[model samples]
Every structure is written in C-alpha cells, then in structure tokens.
Target: MFANIIILILVLLALIFSISKWRIHPFIALILSAIVLGTTLGLGGESTISVVLQGFSETLKWIAVIIILGAFIGEVLRETGGAFRISNRIVKWVGEKKLPWAMGFTGYIVSIPVFVDVAYILLQPVVESLSFKSKRPVLYLGLSLAAGLTVAHTLIPPTPGPLAVASLLGVEMGRMLIINLIVATFAMIGGILWVIFFLKNSWIDYDKKLQDIYKEEQTTTHNELPKGNWLLDIMPIIVPIVLISTGSFVTDNLSGWVGDALGFMSIPLIAVYIGAFIAVFQIAKKDKKNKVNRLVEQAITKSALVIMITGAGGALGFVIKASGIQNEIVQIFSDFPFLGAMLPFVVAAILTTATGSITVSLVGTASMLGPIIDNFPMSPEIVAAIIGCGAFCVFHVNSSFFWLLNRLHEVPPKVLYKTFTAQSLIMGLSGLIGVLILVLFGV
Candidate 1:
C-alpha cells in the first residue's frame, strides 16, 4: 500500500513537472502519467491499455458535446455583440455611481458561456467608456468585473474548469451548478467588497500604447448584422441551466407525462442541445451560410484540445482507481478530517498558482485526487466547489489572466499584487468559509 501511494505521488509530480517546467502538452503528460502509474502498480499491459481507452472514451462521450456546445454558444454571443450590449446596458441602468456592482454583474452573466479572457476583451471597451464617463478608477471596475467573471468561469459548468472538475469527481452538473452558484455568490461579494473598500480611490492613467488601441477600438464600426435581442441572446445560456435544474428536481418528485417531458428536458446533453439550437438560430439568414457555419466550425476546432486534455485526465483517474490505491489513500486522509475536506482546495490553488491555468489546475488536481474523492466527508458537489474556489485564488504573475489585467488596465505590477491578487485571495478564502459553513450545517 505504501509502495502504491509513493508511486502515485511520483506520477503526479512527473505530470506537474512536465506541464509546468518542460512545457510539454498536458494531454501528453497526463497520458504518460497514467502509463507510468499503471506500470508501477504492476497492471498488465493489456489491462492498462484497456483502462486508458475505456476512461478516455467514457469521459469524452459524456463531456465533449457539452463543451463544444458551450464554445459554440460563446462564439455566437461574441460575434453578435450581445455580450457588449448587455454590459453596456447594465452600466446605463445602474448608473455610474454603482458602476463596480453593475460591471460585476455584467461579467457574471457574460462569463456563463464565454471564456473569461474573451469576455474581458469584449467588454473592455465598454468598461473603459464607463470609467471615462464616471471619472471612477479603472482598477475599481476592472477588479470587480474580473472577480465576477473569474468566479463563474471557474465555478460554473460548460465553462470548462468546473465542468471538467465536476465530471472528473462524478458530481452531477445540475447539483454542481446550484451549489457553485450559491457559493460563488459569496466569493464574488468578498471580491466586490474588497474592491469597494480597499480600491475605492485607485485609478490607472492610460499609457500611449493603450490609448492608441482604445482610440482605434472606439472608432471602428461594427458590420450590419441582425441586432440581437437582449433576452434572446442570453436565452441559450440561461434556459439550458433552467431546464437541466428543473429536470433534476422534478424527475423523481413528480410522475406522469409532464414529469417525463421535464425530466427529458433536464438531461444536460439534451438541454444544451436545445440551447445550442437557440444560439444557432440567432445567426441571421443573411449570415448563416457564411458566418454562423464558420463560427460553429471554429468553436468545434477550438474545443478539441480542451476535450483531449480532459479525456486524458479521465484516463489517469481510471488507472488510479483500477490500481486499488484509492482505499489506501482514503485511509491515509481519514487520519486528518479537516485536511480531508480542504485537500482538494489546497491542491487546486497550488496548481493554479504554479501553472497559471485554471483549466490545467482543475484537470490535474481532480485527476490526482479523483480516486479517493468519495472518501471526503462533504458531498461531491461541495467538494467540487471547493476545488473551483481554490483554482481562482492566488492570481499572480504566472497567470495569463494576471498579465491581461496588467496590460489592459495598465496597472503596475506592484499595484496589481496589492489589488487584484488581494481580491482573489479574499474571494477564495470567502468561498472556503462558505463551504465550511455548509459542512457545519451538515449540508
């Protein structure tokens, strides 16, 4: 048992070193780690290969379509200017005095489907405009908006990080969404309050390069496409979640034709398909042949690598479970009860902080810990949320998002450390607090 545990740890270390230091592709690293783990465990070659194949296929079958559909919806939302319109409208509705809160909510909604970086780029112009109009600090709005987007991007399903984590840990998507949303709200508030209290007086003076880019973006006119209806534009992302949740809740509680239909609608795959259909419908007849088709193709192409990495992680997890090391690891964790619950979160934070990629952090940590995941006292849903929360904490120089914040907002490194990093820390700790509360309440 000790030998198996040591072998597993070595394999995980190799995986991390390959991805973080050697710059090897994660898919390759994960595959190699699984192979090494199997060899060390004395699994026969045929069994090892079979387990890898089965795990990869199973995970891809369950998650690939959902990921591609999410990417497709995000592509449509980006191209339609719907995301921009939503943020802009929100800012106006809330008025400038509450700009940080409004931007935070805007990011929260926009990030439901879109990648956080892409969402930031799409909404940057509007946020800049608001900053200029209101005479508020750019850092204030930027930090708040980023906090909201970062939480949802990391916590919510179909955004990749949380989706992959939930899938790896065997957490149901409906439950993950419900619980993560609730916990993430608390984290988001922590970040917002940090911005409000600590960064209330902060501002960033635009540099020449940023000024020129801003001017260019402001001058460019968008092409004449169908103007997107705000609700219609957002429906593809929101409706599916509603349907899936309803299906999850209603299926067992109610019986009859109504129950059957709702239950069927709630299946995540079907629900996402319905959402994708709505999103696809948004492309106008004039643009469908040329633009919409291309966008869908692009989305699929883009999602391929993410799908591969997730599938590979699943393979590694299968090997771990098949090796019978899970029970040994679980028993070891049982010796420390609090550490058992917090282990996933700590692992996720360290990986994210080290690699600067939340997706990588989630896949790596979840795969490494997945075999013993059931041993955690907390429900799988809450455990998944803890992982998501940890993945978002400790945003710093190694992270691409940190560089994006630094470059776009032109905040100095020192200021970013004080503000952005500080806020992420607050949000992360607050998420942990929420999870602890739930644990105590026996939820």
Candidate 2:
C-alpha cells in the first residue's frame, strides 16, 4: 500500500513536471504517464497496452461525437454572425449603464459553444469599445467577460473540459450539467461584484487609446455578416441544453414509450447532434447548402486535437484503475467521506494552476482520482461540478489565457494581478462556498 501511494505521487509529479517544465503537449504527456503508471503497478507490458487502448476508446465513446458536434455549432455561430448577434443583443438589452454585466453575460452564453480564448478574441473589440466610451476601466469589462467565459468553459457540458471530466468520472451528463450551472452562477455573481465595486475604481480606470484600435476592423467585420435572427442565433446552444436537461429531469417521471423516447433523445451525443444539425442552416444562403460540407470538415479538423487529448486522459484513468492503488486509497478515506469528496477539487485545482489548462486539469484529476470517488457524498455529478469549480482558479504567467488577458486588455502586470488573477482566485474560492452551500441544502 505504501509503495502504491509513492508510485501514485511519483506518477502525478512526473506528469506535471513534463507538462509545465518540459512543455510537452498534454495528449502525449497523458499517454506516456498512463503507460508508466500501468507498467510500474505491475500490469506488465501486454496488459498495460491493452488497458491503454481500452481506456482511450471507451473514453472517446462518450465525448468524441459530442465535442465534434459542439465544434460545428461554434464554427457555424462564428461564421454566420450568431456570436456577434448574441453579444450585441445582450449589450442592447442591458443598456450602457450595465455594460460590464452585459459583457459578462454575453461571455457566459457565447462560451457555451465557443472556446474561451476564441470567444474572448471575438469579443475583445466590443469590450474595449464599451469600456473606453463608458469611461469604465477595461479591467472591469474584460475581467467580467473572462470570468463568465472561464465559468462556462469549465462547468458547462459539450464545452470539452467539464464534459471530459464527467466522462472520466462516470458521471451522468444531464445531472452534472444542471448542478454545474448552479455552481457556475455562484461563481459568476461573485466575479461580477468584484469587478463592479472594487476593480472599477482601480488606478487603470480608463484608456482612450483603445477607441482607435478596433474602429476600422469592427466596421469591416460587422459588414461581413448581417445581423442574425435572435431565435435562430440561439438555437444551436439552447436546443441541447433544453433536451438534455429536460430529459434528465422529466424522463423518469414519464412512462412507457414516452419515457423511453425522452431517454433516448436526451443522450448527450444525440442532443448535441441535433444542435449541430440546426447550426448548419446558419451557413450563408448565397453559398448554398454545399458549403456545409466545408464547415463540417473544419469542425472535424478543429475538434480532432481535443478528441485525441480526451482519449489520452481516459487511458490514464483506466491505467489508474488497473494499478490496484485505488482500493488502498479508498480504504484511507473510508472514515472521512467529506474529505474524500473534496479530493477531486483539490487535485484539479493544483493541476490547473500548474498546467494553465483547465481541460488537462479536470481530465487529469478525474482519471487519477475517479475510482475512490464512488459517487462521493452527494452524487458523482455534484462532485463533477466541484471539480469544475476547483479547476477555475488563479491564472498567471504559465497560462495562455493570462497572456491573452494582458495582451488584449493591455493591462500592466500589476493591474492584471490585482484584477484578472485576483478575480479568478475569488471565483474558485467563492465556488467552493457554493458547493458547501449546496451540500447543506442536501444536494
């Protein structure tokens, strides 16, 4: 047991060391780590190879199609101006007085389909323009946007990170999505408050230079795609959310073929496929339906790397199970179930802070910590939410998102630390408070 404990610790350290120090891609690092873990634990070469392959294939069976479909939805939204429409509509609805909040909300919605970094880049001009014109600091607006994106990017299903976590942990997608959304709301609210009251008054309060930067580009880009229909714009995102969430909640209450039908429709893969199919209609009419093939190819191309990484992460989890170490670890936590509950979050947070990739963090944490996770104190789905919350933490030099925040927002390191980094830490800690609050309510 002691030897297995040491082996687990060493495997984790090596994984992190390779990712952060050596800067190996996570897909490769995970595969190598799984191989090492399997063999070191006496699975031997043949069994280790078999476990690795089985893990990879099984993991992808859950997420590959969903992720591919999601990528398609995002690409369609991006190309057809749906993302732009959503942001613009939110800004108009919230009005200028609440521009920061609007930016945050826009980010939350858009990020459900779009990648966080990509979403930020797409919305950067709007954030800058609104902040400068409203005489608000870019930090206030940008941090709010970042906060929303981070929450959705990690917590929401079909976004890859949380979806992968749920898959590796054997969590039900619908239940995890519902709980994660609630926890994410808590984090979002906490972030908005921080930006409004505190960071809004900070030294880098306003900048006029940003006004000139996006002026020409915004006009040219806005002209490229007409304003999309509001309902049409939101369909790709809302369809799956409605279907999966409703199915999870209502299917069990129904009976006979009706219940069976809802259960089948609610499957994440099918639900997301419906959304992606709807997104195809958004392709420009002038180019005809034939252009969709191009978009499909693009979506597949974009999602391929994500699918690979997810598969590798799955292999790592399978290897961990094969190690026989989980039984020993489970024994250690048998007397303290709450501590066991918190383990996923802690592990995920550490890995995220180290790797600067929440996808890798959640995947690594779930694969390694999943066996003993045994439905946790409440439910594995809730634990999945907790893991999502934990992975949302302090981002700094190591993170590409950190550099993007600095570069795009043009905030000095001091301001970046006080604002973006600080907000992320608050979100993670406040998210823990949310989990505790939910647990108290018998979640």
Per-prediction TM-score: 0.93, 0.94
Judged by TM-score, which candidate is best?
Answer: 2
In candidate 1, what are the lDDT values of residues 1-443, reduced to their tens digit?
Answer: 78888888777877777877888888998898888889879898889989999888977886888888888898988888878767766766887788888988888888877888888988787767656555567787888899889988888776777778877888877878888888888889899999999887886666334444444334312222247777888888899889876678778888999888888888777888898899877777785778877988988998898889889988998898899888988888798988888898898888877677888888878877787877887888888988988887688887788899888877798888999888888998988887777767876
Name the weakest run of 10 consecutive residues (lDDT summed) in model 2: 216-225
For model 2, the superposed segments whose C-alpha errors exceed 4 Å read 202-206, 211-225
State the weakest 10-residue window (summed lDDT) of model 1: 216-225
Which pairs clash in model 2?
A: none
RMSD of each: 2.8, 2.4
Q: Encode model 2's per-residue lDDT on 66-180: one tens digit a residue.
A: 8888988888887777887888788778988987688788888889988888888887767777665676777778888988899999898879988888888887777788888
Q: Give the alpha-carbon lDDT of every model.
A: 0.81, 0.83
